[model samples]
Structure formats: structure tokens, C-alpha cells
Target: MRILLTGGGTGGHTIPIVAVVQELRRQRKDLKLFWLGDDHPEERAAKENNIPFQKIACGKFRRYFSFWNLIDFFKIPAGIFQSFFLILGFKPHVVFSKGGYVSLPVIIAAWLLRKKIIVHESDAVPGLANRIAARLASKVLLGFNAHSAETLSAKSLRGKYIFTGNPVRREILKGDPVKAREFFHLSKEKPAILVMGGSQGARFINDLISRSLSKLSEYQIIHSTGVNNVSVIARSDCRERQSNLISTENHYRFCSYLDVAKMALAYVACDLVISRAGANTLAEIAARGLPSILIPLPSAASDHQFANAKIFEKRGASIVVEQKDLTSRKLVSLITSLLKNPNQLETMSKKAKNTITKGKYFLIKKLRISIFKIN
Candidate 1:
């Protein structure tokens, strides 16, 4: 079976698609996977995973008027033609989109070609690209509660909606806590907190954490500082400055990025997570049953990250800290309070365990049977 997967722009969109692609390959070794996206990190990720990767014309879609929007307007037509010829030559049986601006043209081309199209929305609300694609999709898969009335009212949507919580890498659910503790050189006496700013990193979060380093001395820290900020963190000497505050030697570790194996270990080793509120991150946190404090990116398109964080906060699975309101002192206070209350942590963990469904299998089955017609 030939399947074309498309999405790009950020790790938030690309990572979940990678998880789906991994599951697809596992289920059907004979399947042929092709990925098309604008030149972006996700394209490289797809290539690394052995999927045939293609770069296509794509334009960013914005809600408000901007000078770049005019340039993107022309790119849209170019993208459509680019996608048309590519889809025609590749002859895919189905197209699965993880909904990004890059996926818009691909889905439109697939719709014109009369190929089965399936789309997944990672956030609580559909983005512009997904809203447009939903009309043409054979099935619209949701990453949150399928029964939510908000989703039921998605524009141009028909009767083809299914609730299949965002696809999470199953490997993330298993990790050796002891090995993780050793790997990070963490102390058994202190609670370990995992801090991240998504795959690419968040400068603001890094700075906040750096400023709070002294107050966080009581806890072991495993921080993923994003590749771009690694040098900045090192040059600033946050690690050296904070060393005096830590009770044990080398109580803090900073990683530019965490590969799948390391991420699994970090999840298992950490007592709590402090990170951005991207859907993919939340999905992974939910899968691992980890309690988190989310600082939603205030500028995220349509305030989707804030909305995503709210979902978890409402469920008692996580605490939401708006980026605009976040401060080093506040963060440290929240972290210290949560870490000190094991009973509260246990309750939050149990709530987290029940917050989301781990049913990537349901989505995969639909892709195989309904989209691929492999039944």
C-alpha cells in the first residue's frame, strides 16, 4: 500500500505524524511511505526515518494581514500545481495530513485527484488548514475528547469525525527510572523535574528557568534547552552558577535534544514536567501519566496552545501558567509546592492517567481498513 503523509512548520505537527508513520510501518512492513512538506526540519526527520521525502511549494497561512501574506498568496497556486503533479506521479492510495500550512496544498491536490484523504487535528480547535481539509477528508480524527461539542461544530465537517487521541510514540511509555537517574547524574534524595521548550527550544522559558536556578536547588533538573539555546546556556554559565545551590554534585543536566530512548528515560525519571503547552508534548505527557505545569505560548496561532493547556488544567492533569503571567519566582514557588506535596502529586498523576485515551491503534486501524481498504 502506498501512503503519502504530509505536515510541517513545527515539531508540534511533524512529531505526531512521525509517531503515526512509525505505527504504520510496524503494522505493515510492505507499506510504501512518502512524505511531502515545504523545506523544513520535519522533512529531515522523515528522511532520517527512511521515508521518501519531497519538498513542495508551500505558503504560510496567517489569520491577520501581513506583508508576507501577499507573497504567500502567489505561492499557494504554485503549491497546488506542485502537489498535483507529485500526487499524480506517486499514485498514493491515501493521504494522511497532520494539519499544517504545508499540508493545505497537498490535501487540496489529493481532493482534486479523488484520493482518500484523512486528517488529524492535534489541538482542541481545528486550524485554518484542517478546517479547509476537513470538508474533503474521508475521516477527521481528533486528538481530544471525540464527544466535545466544540469539535462537533468544526466548519465544513461532515459525518466523518473520530476521536483518536493524538498519536503518541508507544516507546515513550516505557523507561528505566534507575537508568534515567544515573544517566542524568541525579540524586535519589531530590525530586527530579524535567524542563523543556519543545523540540526546537523556547528562549523565554530557558531564561526563566535560568533565573530560577538558585531557587530550584532542592530539586534535580533534567532540561532540554533546544539546540539553538545550548551555547547560550553554556556561555551564560547557568550551570556553573547554580552548582553551589545544589545539594549533590552535578544535580542538573542540560540536553540540546532528547532522542526517543533518552526521552523515555527522562519521563520515567522525572517527578514532574515543566514545559510549553503544545499538543504533541501534552499527548506524550498524558501517555506517560506525568503531571505537568504548562506555560502556553501566548502568540500561538489562535491561542491554541492556551486552549490545549486549559483542557489538561480542567482535567486536573496539569497546572496552566500563561506565558505572559509567568515569572521566575512564581515558577519556583509552584514547582516547590507541587514537589513537596506527594499526595497532591499522586492525585494529579492518577487524574493524568485517566485524562486521555491511548488509542493510536484505533486511528491506525481506520487508516488500514477504511483508507487503505486492507480489510
Candidate 2:
């Protein structure tokens, strides 16, 4: 069987698609998988996984009118034409799209070619691209129930809508805590906090962490400062003041990025995670049963990050700290409190695990059955 998957522009959209592709490959070794994405980190991720990739030039339709929108409109036709030829050659039995601006043209082209199309919307409020794709797709998958199916029109509700928890990397499904700690040279004696700001990193989070580096030393730190922000963080004067608190040698480790395997290790090695509440990030955290403090990006499309964070918070799996209220002092205090009280951490962790375990595998399996029609 052949499948073409498309999504990009951010790790949020790209990583989940990768997770699904990995699951499909494991289930059917004979599956021919092709990725259609723009030239972005998603493409790099696909390459790292050894998936065959074809680039399609595509652009988003901005909410506001501009000259660039005109340019984008022109690109859409070109992208569709290019996708048409690619789909003809590949002849995929199905096209799975993790909704993103880059996936728009490929989805449209796939529909026109009569390929069975499936779309997964990661947020409660579907992005513009997914809203458009929903009309043409045979199935529309949702990450959460709160999203209005009516927004996609009545046709989506009759036979297509399915609630699949966001797909997460396979490695995160299990991890060896002792091995993970040893790999990162973390002392099992101290609580570990994993800090990640997504692929590109969050400037606001980085700044707050930098200022509170000294306070963070009370706990072991595994900070993925993002590749672009590494130098800025490494060179910041905060290190000079905080060097004594955290071992200049091992108290804190800063990484530019994490592959699927490393990311799994980090998830297992840490006692707590502080991160932006992107759908994929939250899904992985939930799958691992880790307690986290989520700071949703205020600017996320349609304020979806806040909505996503609330879902976890409501389940008692995580604590949501709004970006506007986030400060170095507040973050430091929250981490310190969580670390000092093992009972609270344990309770939160168990809740997260229980909530996620209830449906994690079922969701993935359901999506697989829907896309491949596997019995």
C-alpha cells in the first residue's frame, strides 16, 4: 500500500505526522510512504527517519489581505499542479494530512485525483487550512472534543469525524528511567526538570529561565534551549551569577534539539517538564505520564495553545501558567514547590498517566484503521 502524508511549517504539525507514519510502517513493512512538505524542519525530520520526501511549494492564505496574499494565491495553483503530477506518479491509495498551510495544496490535489483523503486537526479550533481540507476529505480527525464540528459544516459530522488523541513518537511509549538518567549523567538523588520551547525555542521562556538559572539549580535541569537560542543563552551573563548554584560541569545541559530517541530519554529522565502547551508536546508529556507546567503561547493561532493547556489542566495532569503572567519568579517558585513535594508530583504524574493510558493506544489504532481500513 502507498500513502502520501503532508504537514509542516512547525514541529507541532510535522511531528505528529511523523509519529503516524512510523506507526504505519511498523504495521505494514511493505507500505510505501512518501512525504509531501515544504522545505522546512519537517522535511529534515522525514529525512532523518529515512522516509522518501517530495517538496511542494505552498503558502498560507493570510487572514488579512496583502500583496503577499496575491503571490500566495498564485503559488497555490503551482503547488496544486506540482502535487497533481507527484500524486499521479506515486499513486497513493490514501493521503493523510496534518493540517497546516503547506498541506493545503497537496490535499486539494489529492482530492481532485480521487485519492482517499484524511485530515487531522491538532487544535480545538481547526486552522484555516484544515477547515478547507475538511470539506474534501473522506475523514476528519480531531485531537479534542471541544472543537466545533459544525465549523466544518454538517457533512463532517455525518460519517467522517473521529476523535483521535494527537499522535506521539513511538519511543515515548516507553522509557527506562535509570538508563535515561545515566545517559544524561543526571543524579537520581535530585529531581530533574525538562525544559523545551519547541523546535525553534521560545524567547520568552528562555529569558525567564536565564534570569532564574540560579534558582533552578535546586533541581537538575535538562533545557533544550533551541538551536537558534543556544548561543544567546550560553553567552548570557546569568550564567556568571548562577555558575556556583548549578554545577558548571553537569547541573544543567542545554540542547539545540532532540531526535525521537533523545526526546524519549528526556521525558523519562525528568521528574517534571516545563514547556509550551503545543498539542504534540502535551500529547507526549501525557503519554509519558509526566507532570508539567505548561505556558501556552499567547499568539498561537486562534489562541489554541491555551485551549490545549486547559484540557490537561482540567484532567489534573498539568498546571497552566498563562504567558502574560509568566515571570522568572513565578516559574522558579512553581518548580521549587513541585520538586520539594514529591507527593504532589506523584499525584499529578499518576493522574496524567491514567488519563492518557485510557485512550492513547486506542486513538492511534482507530486512526490507522480509518486511514488504511485495516481490520
Candidate 3:
């Protein structure tokens, strides 16, 4: 009947929580929903979704030493206090934490208040935050298979784990190719490739794509360059350069960010996707049965992006191109080769779709059972 959701830091942590919120609302319109997190993209997402949101002070835990670590040490207690007061007042029936530093304080508070807590991890390896949250959580849901989390096996968490393939936004799977083609003013003449750099966008991928525009002339392009990098790539000089390099028959569309509507359309319109291998992004791509070339961020926490990409590659869902080894020429060649073979693309798409868990409705059922048992 009532739910408290928390997660932040990156879209990967926040987006899945949003998907869960959406599903919960669809199933029960009268449900009272509240979000607790830091002042980040999740705040904006909560506002857009009309979920009542309250901010809590949170701190990051870094592996290496930093001057900020000294300051962050104090913030942890402050965050716990903030969470305690907030959770005590809200007193929700259940708290679902999509793992992030922000979720730790919230989960600890929920446990202290004797509320049910469910935590989800989106990586092959659990982060420090999730590992801590798991101790207090009644259930630990995983994006990958349970065996992939070798680090978790040695922990004291005995009965709190289940493998739930990453939750994807249902809206993503509802795009119409005809509507998408018209919406983007794209011709059906050439195969379209969608390039996504996550919510904040990846500078490395953006730069490589900019330089490789000429090489992608055979395909129509739909590029989401993140909100921050859109203007930089949209400047007159950049546009002029892209125009000269791109063939007249090919189309290039650039967007700073894609909302739910545009995102679904882009997914449907594109024949292939080139993206950073964030778990949330891969989940959406897999749900749509799209073949992709994934460029893992070398700097991702715990090198999780590389791990995620490798799994997809092993499953025949995607091609992994490490950022360290990636070049404009290399990316161009891979794209062209993949696109040239329709059968391979189709096979990859089928595998990608198969990777997603069948019967998503079961998650909703499981959540309801958990919540009712708690109530």
C-alpha cells in the first residue's frame, strides 16, 4: 500500500528504481510512493514521475585516499540521522533500495524502524554500498545470475539473494517503427544506428563518434550525446564538419537527451545501437532485442561495465570494444561489418532478447507477496 524507494549516483542505480515504481503504480493506483535520495538526477526523475521526494545528506566511499574522504566520514552519520527522521515519519510498508551510497543510510534507517527492505544489485560484483545494504535487507535481488557475484558468496548473507534480471522500463518495449521514423524525419532507405552515452554521456564515445562521422556515411545516425555535450557538438563548426563528412543520402540526428517517448522511438527506429555498457542501457537494449556494439567505460566502478559487456558478448547479444583499445577507425569498421550481415544481426537480436527474464509479471507478484507478508 505504501512504498519508500531510494537510489542515486548514476542513472543505472536510479532508472531501475524508477521502472519498479512505474510498475508498482500501474498495479495499484492508490499506492502511496515516496523517494529518498541525494540531490541528483533521481530528484528530477522523481519530480517528472510525480513521486513525493525528500533529500538526505549522503557520502561516497572511495577505495583510494582522497581529501574528500575525511569530510565524507562525517557525512555518513549525518545521513543516517537524516534518514532516521525521514523514515520514521513516512513509515512505509516496504523500502526498495536500488543500490547506491545514498541507499545505505536509507536502508539502515528502514531496518531500525523495523520495516521490510529489499535491495537490488546491478553489477556482476556487489559494490561496497550494496554489500552493506544486503546485511539489513530481507531480500537481495541481482541483475546478473547469482553465480557471477563471487564476492558475495563468502559474505554472511545466507537467504537474502535472488537473481532477477535487471528491471527495464516497459515503455521502452512499446515503440512503433513507423511512428519513430516519422517522428525523427528519418528515411527507411538506410539502416539506422543509435548511439547512446548514458544519461550524463561519455566524452570518450562522443569524441570518437564525432571523428568517425565520415566513416558512418552508409548508415542513418541517431545520437544521444547527453544533455551536457549536446551544445558542444551542435555548434556551427561541429555541424559544418559533420555535414561535409556525411553523405547526402545519409541522415544524422543529434539529441542532447531523450525523454521516455523519444527514447522508445529511437530504440524502435534503429537497426543497431552503439553505446556504453551500463546495466540499465543493456537491459533496455536487450528488452527490445537490439544488436549493439558496447564500449565499456574503463573507469566504471569495479570495472563493472567491462564485466557487463563481456557477459553480453559471451551470450551473443553484443560486441565488446574496450575504451582503452577503441579507436574511430576500429568502431567504424565494426559497425559496417555488423550491419553488412543481416543474419548475424538478427541472430544477435534474438539472443539479446532471450537474455531477458521471461514472465516479468512474476516480479510484480513476488513484490506483492513480500509486501503482504511484511504487512
Candidate 4:
């Protein structure tokens, strides 16, 4: 069996597709898989995973009219033509899309070729691509339960909308705490806090962390500062400054990225996580039962990250800090308070685990059967 997977422009879209591909490969070693993504980091991730990849040029239709909009408009036809030839030669039995601007043309091409289509929408409000693809796909999968069957068009409802909780990489599902600590040289005695800014890193969060590093030293810290901000952060000497303030011990570590296995370890070793509320991150955090301080990217499409964070906050699994209200003092206070209150942390962790456990496995198995048609 052959399958074509397409989605990109960010790790949020790419990572989940990679997760599904990982599962598909595990189940069917003979199956052939190809990834179609923009000439971006997502394609690099696919290559790192040893998946065959093809880069396509695509653009989004803007909500507002601009000169670039016309150029982007033209790219659509070019993208569709490019996708048509790729699909014609590849002849995938099915095309699975994690909706994004990059997936729009591939999905349209798949529809034209009468290829069986499966799409996963990872947001509370579906993206424009998935919203359109819903009309053409045989199945539309949702990551959340906010949208109802009746809300979809008749065609989409007939095709079936299944809530297949987001697919998380297998390594993340099971990380080794001891190994993670040893690999990162983390102290087992100190509370560990994992701070991240998604794939690109968040400048606001980075700045806050830089200011709060001294206070945060009471707890061991692992911060993924994102590639762009690494030099700035490293040169700023947040680690050195913290060591100076709190006895010269290795209580902090920073990196631009972490591979899946290392990331799994970080998750396993973490007592609390501070991160942007991306769907993929939320799934990973829940999978590991880590309590969180979620600061949603205010600019995320459809304000989806805020919604994602609220879902966890509602269950007392996380605390949501809007960007506008986020400050170094507030963050330090929250972390210090959460860490000191072990019972509160345990309660939040249990609740977080419960909320995610409610549907994760069933949804994963259901998606597997629906896409691969395996009983």
C-alpha cells in the first residue's frame, strides 16, 4: 500500500503527520510512504526521519487583499499542477492531510484524481484548507470535540467525523526519566521545569525567561530557546547569571532543538512544563501527565491555542497565562507556588492524565482502522 502525507509551514502541522506515519509504518512495514510539504523545516524533519519527501511551493489565500495575495493566488494553480504530476506518478491509494496552507493544493489534486481522502483538523475551528477538503474527503478527523456533526455540511457528515485525539510520536508516549536526567545531566534532587517556545520559539517567553532565570534557579531548568533565539539567549548569559546568583551549580540547560528521544526524556523528567499552547505540545504534555503553565500564542490562527489551553485549564490541569498578562514576576511566582505545593501539582497531574486518557487510545485505534482499513 502507498500513502501520500502533506502538511507543513510549522511543526504543529508536521509533527502530528509524522506521528501518524510512524504508526502506519509500524503496522505495515511493506507500506510505502511519501511526504509532500513546503520547502520548510517540516520537510527537513521528514528527511531526518528517513521518509521520502518532495517539496512543493504553495501559498495561503489571505483574509485581506494585498499585492502578495495575487501572487499567492497564482501559486495555487502552479501548486495544483505540480501536485497533479506527483500524484499521477506516485499513485497513492490514499492521501492523508493535516490541514495547512501547503496541503490545500495537494488535497484539491487528490479530489480531482478520485483518490481516497482522509484529513485531520487539529484545531477547535477547522482551518480553511480542511474546511474545504471536508467537502471532498471520505473522512474528516477532529482533534477536539467542540465541533458537532450537525455543524458540518451534509456531505461531510455522511463521510463521518471522528474525534481521533491528536497523534503523538511513540517515543513521547513513553520517555525514560532516569535516562533523560543522565542525558541532560540534570539533577534528580531539584524540581525540573521544561520551558519551550514551540518550533520557532516565542520571543516574549524567551525574554521573560531571561529575566526570571535567577529566581528559577531554585528549580533545575531545561529550556528549548528555538534556533533563531539561541545565539541571543546564549550570549545574554542567562545560565551564567543564574549560576552566579544561586551557587555555581549546573541547574540550567538551553538548546535550540531536541530530537524525539531526548524530548521524550525531558518530558519524563519534568515536574512542570511552561510552553506555548500548540495542539501538538498539549497532546505531548497530556500524554506524559505533566502539569503545565500554558501561555497561548495570542496570534495563533483562530486563537486556537487559547482554546486548547482553556480545555486543560477547565480541568485544573494547567494555568493559562495570556501574553498580555505574562511577566517575569508572574511566571516566577506561579512556578514557585506550583512547585512548593506538591499536592496541587499531583492533583493537576492526575486530572491532566484523566482528561487525556478518556479518549486518546480509542481515537488512535479508530483512526488507524479508518485509514488503513485494518480491523
lDDT of each: 0.80, 0.81, 0.81, 0.81
Per-residue lDDT tens digits for candidate 2, residues 1-375, read: 998889898888888888888788778878888999898878897898888998888977777768898888888889999999999999998899998898999999998888898899877678889988988888888887545365565744567888776777777877799999997889989888898887777878877877888777767888776655543555454334432222243578766666777889889999999999888887788888899999998888778888888878888989999988978889888988888889999999988876545555776876787888721
Question: TM-scores across all candidates?
Answer: 0.91, 0.91, 0.92, 0.91
lDDT of 1 at 83: 90
Whole-structure CA lDDT of model 2: 0.81
Off by over 4 Å in 4: 63-65, 148-159, 235-249, 358-362
lDDT for residue 269 in candidate 1, whole number 0-100: 93
Q: Give the C-alpha miss distance for residue 137 in model 1, angstroms.
A: 1.0
RMSD of 4: 3.7
True-structure Cα RMSD, model 1? 3.6
Model 3: per-residue lDDT, tens digit, 1-375? 888989998788888878888777776777998999998888988998999999988889887999998898788888889989988888788898988888888888888888888888888767789888888888878788754456577457876777777877778778789889887878888899999898778777887887888777778888877755543355444334532222223477786677777898999999999999888898888888899999988878888888889889999999998888888889989999999999999999999987755654554445445544655
For model 1, residues 1-375, the per-residue Cα lDDT tens digits are 899889888888888888887777777877888898977777788877888998988889687889999999888789889999999998998899998899999999999999889888888877889878888888878877643327447555757777667777767877788888877777778899998998778888888887788777788888887766543444454434432222223566776677777888889999999999888898888777889999988888878888888889999999998888888889999998999999989888877877775443554455445445521
Cα error, residue 299 of model 4, in Å, equals 0.8
Error of 1 at 255 (Å): 2.1
Deviation from truth (RMSD, Å), model 3: 3.4
